[model samples]
Structure formats: C-alpha cells, structure tokens
Target: MIFRQIKLPPMLGYLLIGMAIGPHALGVIPSSEEASHLAEFGVVFLMFTLGLEFNLAKLSAMRHIVLGLGLAQVLSMLALVGSAALLLGLSWQVGLALGAAMAMSSTAMVSKLLTDRNELQTPHGQNAFGILLFQDLAVVPFLIMIPVLGQPAEQLTSSLGFAALKIIVVLTLLLWLGQKLMRPWFNLVARQHSSELFMLNILLITLGIAWLTELAGLSLALGAFLAGMLIAETEYRYQVEDDIRPFRDLLLGLFFVIVGMNLNFAILLDQWPLICVLVLILGPIKVMIITALARLFGNSAGAAWRTGFALGQGGEFAFVLLALAAGEQIIPPAINQSTVAAIIVSMLITPFLIQHSDKLVLRLASSEWMNLATNLHQIAVRSMANTGHVILCGYGRSGQSLGRILHSEHINFFALDLDPEKVREAGAAGESVVYGDAAKREVLIAAGLMRARALIVTYAETHSAMKILEMVHQIRPELPVIVRTQDDSDIDLLKNAGAAEVVAEIMEGSLMLASHTMMLLGVPLNKVVRRIREVREARYQLIRGFYRGTHEESDESDRQQPRLHSVQLTQNAHAIGYQIGELGLNELHIEVRSIRRKNQPSIQPDEQFQLQNGDVIVLLGVPENLAAAEMLLLQGNR
Candidate 1:
C-alpha cells in the first residue's frame, strides 16, 4: 500500500519488508524450510500466468524482436559476463550461472513502468517487452541446466543428456494431449454452472501437471508454465487468468520476501566495495550491449537507447536463479551474497535510469532532436489552418466516435496518437491524425492548443490523462479540456488539475443502460429522459442544459427532446431593451437557461432582469417552443 501510494513497485516493498522481519535483521520471522517451499509456489503460479499470456499469434507478430533482438541480448550478455567471470578465476559452472542470472531483467517492474508511463505501444517499449519475454523463456533452460551443472564433472554430460530427453518427451506429451483434452474437460466443468468447481478443476490441472514434472526430476515452475500454455489454447484462458491472479500475486510476494530474507546485512557491509563495483558495472554493461543490439536490429538511436535503459536492471528471475545456484553450490556463499546485493541495488536505480533516459538520449543521440522536430512538424502541418478545432489526445474507439460527430457538424479536429498503425490506417482514410505522444507539451502545442476550442482525452488511464492535463493547462489555461475516466473516483482530482469537465464512462454507461431498461419496461419516454437528465445533472455540473447541435436537427426524435438554444440580441431586436418578465417567453414554454454577455461568464437571470443589446439569452425548451421564443425575442411576436 505504501509503495502504491508512492507509485513505486510493490515487489520492492515486499523485499524491504522481508528484510526488516527476516532472521538476518530484526528476526521477527525465523528462517524455515516449510516457508521457503511454500514461497516456491509463487514462482510456479508466476510461470503459469506467463504461459497463459503466451499467444501464438502475438509471438508470430513479434518473432523478429523476440527471436532476433531478444536472443542476441541473452547470448551476448552470457558470453561477455561469462568471459569476465573466467578471467576472474571462477569455475566454468559459476561463470555460466552468473551469466544466466545477470542476463535476466525484471519483467514485472519494467512492464508496470511502461504501462504507467503509457509507453507500452511505443517502439522502445515494445522492444523492451519482447526482450523481457525472451528472457523469461531463457530462464527455464537455465533452471534445468544450473542444477545439472552441479553434478560431478564425469556425470554432468550424461545427466544433461538424460534431462534433455526427459524434458522433450514430457513436454511433447503434455502439449500434444493437453490441448486435445483441456477444452473438453473445461467444458465438462463449466456445464456444472459452479464457479467453485471450475476453479478447483483449474487448480487441479495446474498443480497436478506441476507434480508430474517434479516426479520427472524437472522444475515445478516449468510444468506450471506448460500447464498455462495448454490452457492458453482453450476458450477459458481469460477466466482462468482472472481466477488465478490472487494466488499468483500472493505467492509471488512471498517468493520475493523469501529471496530478501537471504540478504545478510553483515555480508553486504563487509563486501560493500565489491557489491558497489558490481552494481556500477552491471547496468552499464547490459545497457551498452542491448543498445548496440537494438540499433543493429534497425531501431532508431533514441528508441534503441530507451530499450537498453529499460532492461538494464537485474530481474525477479535473477533472485530465483541465484537461489537455485546457491542451493546447487555452483556459487560460493560470499559471492552469492555480493551478487544478490548488487542486483538489488541495480533494481533500485532502474526506475531513475529509465525516467531520465529520454533526456540522456537527446543529449547523446543527435538524431533524437530531429525525430522530435519531424514529429511535431507533421502535427503542425495537419493543424495549421484549423481554428477552434477539437484536439483529440487519443484516436481509439471513443476518439473515433467523437471525431465522426465533430466532422458531421463541420467542426475541424486534429488527433495525436502514439500507435503508428492507427495513425497510418486512419490517415490513409484521410483523417487529420498524426503519430505522436499527447503527454508531451510540444505535441500538444503542434496540435494547435492555442487555437483549439477544446481538448478531449478519450483514453481512461489516469496517469497519462493527468500528464496531458498538466501540459494542456500550462500551454492554454482557458481552453476547456474534457477528461474521460472510468469512474467518479478521479473526477475531483482531474477537475482540480484544470479539467473543465470530467466525463465518467461508468456513470454515462449506467445512465444509458437505465434509460434503455426503463423504456423497454413500458415507462414513458419523457419520464425516462427526465430521469436520465436528472442523474446526469447531478453528476456533471458543466454538462447541464443540453446544447442542441445543427446535425441533431435531422433526427425527428431530437426535435422533441428538451434542448438549449442561444439567441443573440442585436441593437434593433425588440426584446433587447425589454425586461425578462415582459418578454413572455414562459408563455412559449421556454426557460431562460442563462445570459451570456460579451467577455463574461454565463449567468442565470431572474425575472424582471433587463436585457441589453448584444446579450445572448440561452433558452431551454422543445424545438417548436424554442423557435417561438426566439421569434418573440427578436420580432416581438410569436
């Protein structure tokens, strides 16, 4: 909770909490074999989740990055680090183990950070994710190999060969037969109409396969991962994922805590100098290697640098691999302690490194500034002649709907989206959309922030929305920005951040559902509409008094709906100098919504309020009544 409040990874907090309570520190929690074994289930569930997410189509699409860039990164890191270990006089086994551990980067941390920064769709972010995916697959082989390496040198080759054959046969059987039986078995369970039964069946499949692999002398996590992969092919994958998340997270937290308990403060302090050296070299070396590989794979210099910075840190799997290596006696206790300490330090600094990487790239990579300029230039070109146009921060479903409406009303709009494919396809269809990050001030400015009448953030992510709002308010304070949210939870926060209106999708959706349900239930349409209006007025202050649009006039039903119409009084208008009471708009069934004067906010005017020339009186009524009221205001006859 504390980490979440501070926006840091909860895994880091779990480790710290474990350190404070473990035997090495305050000793509130004693070291026990049973606890360690229990925590290992966390890794099992973690692998299971990883397997569930392994979609064949997704892998095929990213095969180049995952196979090319990801494969090269792991191999290069292993070779380079292994060579370094050999020069330092470590045994071959130790070198291999160390290389494997360092080759892995924290998938959990990097993924969460990318999502929070809304960069997962960017080139660097996608490349980082691909690398992380391959690293995760790489861990399984190391899990199998590290243990086999611990055998006597004479028995090692035979043991490795036997292990390999066993793994092959087991995996082939599970995958080939599991896919055939999984769907039918799940169907049988689901037909029972019992969630508990479905859940139990899933658990049974996960653990039963895990136990089988253990019996075959393989890692429990490997079997669990296989189980997940089989289930991924089934229609029940999403449901199983949702059901298994709680177990995965709890066990994963416990796993990290146990890893942390292994940290000896005394060992760390004694070997602080060595640990510091490892920390300093580890991240920089990985960054250089991955950066070069990314560039070689055709990523732009800036994106390549970002990918490198993102995956430079040691990962959760490093702890798992390190613990396994320690257990197998591949690494000495002192060396293991120092290496673990270094990894922890590297993880601690990773967030800071990634946060500043863009700035660093701009300073180091001359091409980055050019990239930014080219991007902004495209946006500026699209928006150059568009005055009072809507600037859409995202061009997803919601933005597309809004864009169509705006276009129909003859209102110009320019959209900025990070997805290249979305921009390309939409642009090919003649949309004024450009590929750019809306969170950046320059992108917003290039989209005509100063000239835009309003800005609408269609995406529901609060963090990115907040950043966009910050930049928008900085560039154009008076421009009305409508922010979309999932619920009312962040309405106040967004409004406080200068959003003119925060539209909660949940609220709007519920209102729509209720309205439809009421009409279908034979409730009067007028009553249903009034109910929806009341609910909306209660929730959205700025949205009160529905403003009729020109496009809506073609819909006959819209003519019957209560609408707001603004009448501008000219110098010769009959009602210009008359009082509100004398206008007799009430006889026409019109309600004065507000009075808008030049350079002033709209205000509600009471009866007997005198109207002056140039005052725009907003009247709310049905179309016929509103039209009659307008005639009465202008010509003094209805």
Candidate 2:
C-alpha cells in the first residue's frame, strides 16, 4: 500500500511507522550508526535537488533578506539557547553546541512541505527560502566552529581558521568554475542525445562536487546544491532534473525512513517530562518570538506566523551538529540523546501545526495587537496600488512584446508572471509586475485584477487559462477579457467562459502558412500578402466598430473604402510587356495589388511588368472598373 502511493509524501507515514517499530516498541530497526549512514543519503539528495532549483538571480536580488534576516534568526536563537543551557548548569562547550543545534531550521522538511502545499511562490515562501539559503551556507561556518568551539580555544583556533580558509577557497573556485564551465559541458552532452549518458553525467557531477566540498571541510550537501545551481544555468536543466529526480526521491525517502527509525523510544521515555516541556513550552515560545521578529521586519501577520510556525521544529542539521559535538565530548551523551528525541517529536508535530496555521492566525488576528498588525499590512498593500492600469497574466514572448508596445504607448499596465526572476526584473525596471499564479483567485486579486480596465491572459497551460477565465468571470463578469490559446478547439470554450476575444493559435498559424505558400507560388513581390492582410484588418475593424455601435447603417464613408480584388491570368492579355505605370491603369480607375504566377503569388514583381501565361493579377478599385482592368490585363495571358 505504501509503495503504491510512492508519489505521495511518504515522510509522515514513514515517521509514524518508524515510531511503531522503533527500539522501545517492536524493535524492527535498531538505533545503530548504520541507520544514521542510511539517513544521510536523503539529506544529500535533498540538498542536490535544492541546488538544482536554486535561482541565482533571485538569490542575488534577495541577498539582503537571506543574509540579514537569516543571520538575525540564527544569532538570536543561539543567544537564547546559550542562556538557557547556562541556566541549566551545562558546560560552556555543551551550551554552545546546544545553541548551534537549536539555531537552525529544517530546510529539507520545510521546503518539501511548502512545495506540497504550493506555497513556495508566495512572499512568505520567498522569505523562508532566503532564510534557508543562508542556513545552508552557514553549514560550512558551523562545521568549522564546532571543533574549535567545542575544544579548548587555544589549541583548535589555528586548525579551525585553516579549515575555514580551505572551505572559502573551494567555495570560491567552485562558484567561479562551475558557473563558467558546466553549461558548455552540459550542452555538449545534450547534443549527443543519449539519455543514459546524460543521467550518468548528472549523477557523477552531483556526487563528485559533493565529495569535493566534503573534502574541503564543508558539508557534502552544500557541494551538491552548488552543483545543481551550476547545472540550472544550462539549457538542459529541465532534462537534467527529469533524469536525476528518481534517484533523488528514492534516496530522500530512504533518508526520511532512517530519520524515523532513529527514534529511540527508550531515551524518549526516560526524558519524557523534559521532552514534553521542550515540545510544548519551548516550541510555542520560540515560534512567538520568531513571529514577532518577522513582523518587525515588515512581514504580514499571516506571513510572520507562517515563518514562525515553519521553523518551530528543530532542524535536521541540528542533530548533525549535536552528534559532532558529542563526539568531541562538548555535549554530554544524555543531552544529545534528549535533544534528538525532542527534535524528532517536534518535527513529527510540525506538519500539523503548519497545516492549522491559518486557523491559528485567524484566531490570533482577533486580538487587538494582531488586528493592528493586520491593519498596518493592509495599509502597506493599499499604498502600493496605483491606478489606471491593465493587468497582463503571463510574460512569455508575446506578452513581453505586448508589454513593450504598451510601454511605448505610455499605457499603465501591471504584469503578473509565474516566473519569479522575470517578475523581479520587470519590477526592477519600474514596471508594475508581480510574481503570482494567474489561475488562482488569490493570486489574481494580488495582481490587482479588480482595479484594472482589462485583463489579458497571454501565456498559460490550457487548464490554467480556463481556470483564470472562470475566476475572472466569477469575480468581475463585466471586465473585458482577452485570452490567447494554442488550439482552435478551446475558442468556443473560452468565449463561453467570458473571454471577449480568443486569439486562436491555429488561425495565426494558418495565416502564416497562407502568406508563405502564396510567396512560394510566385505571388507578386510588391504586395504579395500585404494587401490581403490590410483588407482583413479593415474588415475586422469594421465589424468591431459595428458591434460597438460606432458604425451606423447610413455610413457611406466606410463603404467607399477600397476592397481586395483579384483576377486570374488568361492566354491573351493587352497589358503584356507594358509597365504598370505606362499602362495608364490609374486613368482606368484601377490599382494593381499583386500578381500570381504558376498558381501562386510571385513575391517579387516589377512596375515594368510583362504579362505571362498562368500569371494572376490582383487589383483594387470600384467593382465595375476592376472588372474592366481584369478583362484587359488577362486578354492575352490565358
């Protein structure tokens, strides 16, 4: 049953199952060092995938939040824990170890949860990701500090500094060389079109880089993450991700299972009172403090609570640090064991806490302080909203071109894009672009759909587009909507769902085909398909004007406009060997539009024209005069 649902999140179930079979219960899997080794692979692959998805541009843009907020959280948590450990009369080294362990949050678990809930693109998610990024980076520094901080300072300082220097050198070299070299290598591999070879190369690169980082005294996970970032820049990134995902998932699943198997119920039972205190008292207190700090940094009340709730559990990395410190005799075996039990329990309860965070926040918001916070956040959002706008969903090629045109026309438009980097870049350029999912009503609301004059959905999967249209109709039925779809089959559905205009993809493709086919079939070069396009545009405009009640039935001025006209060439033609200008065609009240040769429009034509057999002349004039010109031009050609 569990294997059948492998695609589902197996972590929670695995944890519960592990608890049932752990040492104090059925004793199926012992609390052995081998269990720890098995669990480490999960961490490795989790880090590898995280690296694969890491967007360097976004990291650069959010560096302040990543560095500042992340560092503050770490330092503040460390300070509070260090004080508590001292109050408990633990040794200074043990105090430091405990502080370091408690300072971190579970990047793997939180990210997985966020991804599952589809909250990873939200503002809070970005902030949480930034913090996690810094924490991942902090692993190197923490490893260096462990040996020195746990031991007598005088003896370990020089070694610690040397280790730190080596790590810095390796990281710098990897970032520089990886960014410069990996893309071309991947591109070369991609051209070979061997899936097995590509998969092999991806594994080698991920493991090789992780080993290199480990050899440099940094975590293997960090190295794998960096390798992923390098590959992310390659054109073959998606393929690489697809190839490596199975291995990553299997290893990560094994890792979580091992983490669960490590639950030593005996130790947990011995320290049940302390463990409960940590889970109940310390957990909520830590969350509250973190929430307050996050709010201070301008996060919404909801965002702050989410940030706090997500970090409530002690991180997986904390166990790593604690184990390392225990080996160094810095923290006692009992303290380490108790901390592990407390961490596991906290982690097991965390998902439920986060799942219920919305209700928790809503209840909290009923309070005076929270109400004030919510009001302040609402004010900030309102102040950011500017008017006279068009909201464009999707920023793909066509959408981008439209945005440029809108900019040139000095139109006020805001773009909503799923791609975070594009959204960030567009915003940086002083465009009102937002990172959001167009399919979701909340995301649409965030993009100011209600305030806009028009909504344009330029790029989306069909289902997503349909959902957006449905949401638009439900929210503001009268709002003008334009949608672009790649299939003609969706046109009727889009229209029925309240799209004012559906630019069918097939229509555009057919038009392109017709123009190219005519050119290939020897359409006159001077006009070719231009006159056809113009007439179509004019007809469309006329129809639109009529629909808008702007074109009256009595309007003769529109009727006087020239229409598209064409005639087939015949064996006899009086105009043969005569230049179009010399033919006195204007006196005949006729205009040459194009000429078709060999059953096709000749793209190249000359004013000094000679009629040929099977050539077709297209003309524009009054209906009667055009007939006269057609008869004269085709008299001899046929």
Candidate 3:
C-alpha cells in the first residue's frame, strides 16, 4: 500500500519493508539466515515459471533480439563492469564475480513495469525482455563459474573444463528425460481429477528437477527452469501456470524480504560516499552501453534510450552473486556490502528512469539524435492521414478475410500488426497493412484510429484484446469495435470491456453450418440470409439483456425467458465432486445442454458425469433459476 501510494514498484516496497523490519533495524525478523533459506525457493519457483512461459515459437520470432542483442549486452557489461571493479583494486575473481552479477538486469521488474505501461511489445520493451531472457539463460554458466573463480590457480583450468563437460552432459540428459517423461507424467496426474494432486505433482516436478540439477553440480534454480521449459512444450502449460502462481508469488515476496534483510546499514553508512559515487557512475554508464548496443542492433534512439533506462540497474541476481562470492571468500565483507548497497540503490532508481524515459530522451538526445528513420516515419504519417477507414488490429486469417472483403467492396481500410513478416508480405502485394502494435496508443494513432470508421480485433490473446479495447476507448469511445474470440465465454466480457460486438467463431461457424444445410435443403438465398440475420439478432439481444442485467423477463415475451448461462468450475467448487444428475440442476429448472472441457465440447453429456476443475457447463433456464444454479456451482458441495 505504501508503494502503491507513492507509485513505486512493489519490488522496492518489498525491499523497504524487509529492511525496516529486519535484524539491522527493528529486529522483527532478526535472523536473515533463516529468511534466506526459506526464500531460496523463490528463485527456484521464479525460474520455473519463467521456463513455463517459454515459447519455442515466440523465442524463434525474437531470435535476433534474444540471442544476438542479448548476447552482446551480457558480454559487454561483463567486460566493462569487470574492468571497472579491477580498477577499484579488487582481485580478478572478485571483479569477475561483480561483473557477472551486474551483467543481469531484472527480468521480472522490467517486464512488469513495461506491461503495466502497455509497452512490452514496443521495440524497446521487446529488446529489453530479450536481453533479460538471455541473461536468465546465462545464469547457469555464471553459477558454475562462481566456484571456479574461488579456486586456486592450479585447479582453475581443470575446474573450468570439468564444469563445461558436466553442464553438457546434464543438459543433454535433462532434455532427453524431459522428452521421455514430462507430458505422460502430467497427463496421468491430471486424470486423477484432484486439484491438490495436480498441484503436488507440479511441485514434485519442480523440486525433483531442482534436486537433480543440484546433484549434478548445477544450481537448483537451473533445474527448476529446465523443468518449466520442458512443461512449456506441452498442452498443459497455461493450467500449470495458473495452479502454481500463488506459491511462486508468496515465495518470491519472501525472497525479496531476504534481499532487503541482507542490506548492511553499518557498511552502507560507512561507505555512503562510495556507494553514491558508484550508483551515479554505474547507472549512466550502463545506460550508455545498453543504449549503444540497442542502437547498434537497429533500435531507434528513442527505443534505445527507453531500453537502456528500463534496464539501468544491477539486478536481483547481483545480490545472489554477491552473497555467493562473500561465502566463497572471493570478495571481502566490506566490498560485498558496498556492492550490495550500490546494486540495491541502482535498482531503486531504475523505475524512476523507466517512468520518465521520454523526458530523459528529450533532455539528453538532440533533435537529430532522436534517430527517427525517415521512411518509416513518413509512411506512418501518411497512414495517419487516412480517414473513414476501418482499422483492423490483426493480420491473420480472420483479419485477411475481412481485408479482402473490404477491398472487393472498394471500402477504405488499414490493417496493423506487430508481425513484420506479415506486414512485409502484405505490403509487397500492395495491401494497406503496416507493422505496429494496436495496444500502443501511439501506434493506434499512427494507424488513424481517431478517424477510423471501425476497429476490429482478431487477436487470439485475450489480455492483448482487452488492452486494445481499453486503449481504443480512451482514445475514441464512440468508435465501433468488433472483437473475435475462440469461444462464446468471452462475448459478454468483451462487450463489457467496450467492444461494440464480440464474434465467437464457434457460434458463428455453427450458424454458418446451419445456413449451408438449409440452403442445401432448397432454401432460397434471400430467405437464408434473412434467417441468418434473425439468428444473429436473437443472440445479440440475449447478450444485450445479459449485460444490462435485464434477463428476468423479455419485453416481447412478457414472461421469464430461458437464458444461456455458462458456469465455469473453480477449484473445489460445489459441482466438482457431484455428478450432474446428483447435483439436481433439474430441481432449479436449469438444463445442462453441454459441457466444454479444454476447448472440446460434449453436447448433452451423461447425467452421471462428474465435472473437473475448469469445466464450463452450458445451462439454459430462467434468470433467477440460472442464478441459483450458478450459486450452487460457486458454493460447491457446502
């Protein structure tokens, strides 16, 4: 709450609270050692989740930034920061330790901030994430090198060579084992229909892998990360993320608390001047280096500065490295304390730098240094001049179909997408499409959002679709917006979110199928069109009634109308244990017409069927009766 009030990131708040309540201060949590042991899982869980969010497809898409620019940033930071530490009279090992630590930027912090600001897909934000991802992947080797750095001259080469060979063998074995066992193991656990069991299985997977990795002379965190990556390849990734999130968050908070407790106030007070000097020097120097690297990789100056400022901090990993170095006697307590203080201070300032990145660019970069590419800017400006055109917010199948129809009808339309390949291909064929993210207000404006007749979102990501809705409403509230969804469940949500219309492909495709069948039965074209329109109108009216809270009775019917109710099963909900027949939905006059599990539908399912968590039951009944059914679903067997 304090951080929220001050508009600071929660990470800083966690750090502050930990510091204030810690042994060095109030002594509420006097034993930092105890906290550290407990908080270690925070890193383990964090790495696990990071791996779970892995996308082979997305990683491929971001290969250049994640691998190329990311590699460049890490190597450069290690060289520069390590050199600086050496200049400060630190031993080579100590310098290397500090360098490796400082080379990482906070993935969680930067990604969270950029996501909140709706900039994660912007050129800068993407670049920053890519670099952070690489840094995360780099942690494994860095951990291996830590003990090597602590070794004497005689054992250095042997230690390095042995570590390399061990890493290769471990990685290959982990991958092979994961491919053989991961999906099958999870599938068996899922069939048990117990959320607790599912969660436990996940914990086992995480800790088991972590244990294996530690046993193989690698970090426990790396093992957890590999577990997550293996899971990411399967179909259960989203559910795993949802199920494990609470544990991850609580442990992560504890981790931050441990970090805060590690701050030595006595050392900080004694080395205040040095700490200040280092923070000041490090922030700007890191920014310059990161900015230069970003620009070298084709990011414009604006994007480069934004990326630099967003990541101008010694990251969370720095604390881990310093603690390890201190333990290994690679760095003295005094140097460790000072480096920790400097790192924390830098972290404290990163949010401020990112928040005011625009002003920073304006202040530091000259007009010419803004580095706006002439052709892209001119093209964007020209696109912005378009009026009364439809703005299509995706370039996939649905969007392309819409565009073709618009073209055939000689209607003005412009499509925007972040997929450079799609935009390039379409533009080569003289299509009015451009590369841009619609979730960015600037990008929307550049796509002529203000003067557009309508906005259509065909993106599959619900979060992205919702974000675009909010952005569009903020800019043009009255503009017509039609959003496409994979299921009917999001229809009411999308509409409530300010989408003028929500098109669920499943429902519409069914309607299309029915229409084709009718035509095949010798129905006239005009009659078929009229029937389709009537069906659409009826669905829209029902949706309108649902949103307006007027489903008790219809004006035309003058009686309670049967309304569609979708009840999603939450963990341990009342309906989960009982079979449909046993629950007695019939008592509430709620007919269970169908059930949707994992995108597959079971129409008029067996009455004796038990429901799993996440099952969406389709009910048709009067409003008050459906409400009772919903209440039962939510209330569970209690």
Which of the numbered candidates is closest to the native, going by highest lDDT?
A: 1
Residue-wise C-alpha lDDT for candidate 1, range 327-440, written one tens digit per residue? 889999888989888888888899888778878999978999999999889889888999989899899999999999999988899998889999999999999899988888
What's the TM for model 1? 0.87
Q: For each candidate, how many residue pairs have backbone atoms clashing (under 3 Å)? A: 1, 21, 2
lDDT of 2 by residue, 317-346 (tens): 776677667656787665676777777777
Q: Candidate 3, residue 91: CA error in Å?
A: 1.0
Residues 131-177, candidate 3: write the lDDT tens digits.
88888878767777896687898998998898889889988998998
Name the weakest run of 10 consecutive residues (lDDT summed) in model 2: 541-550
Runs in model 3 deviating more than 4 A are: 1-8, 53-63, 165-191, 215-217, 229-238, 362-387, 390-411, 416-418, 435-638
Ranking by lDDT: 1, 3, 2
Give the per-residue Cα lDDT of candidate 2 at 382. 43
For all candidates in order, the CA lDDT equals 0.87, 0.69, 0.78
Name the regions of candidate 1 deviating beyond 4 angstroms. Answer: 547-638
* Model 2 residue 532 lDDT score: 52
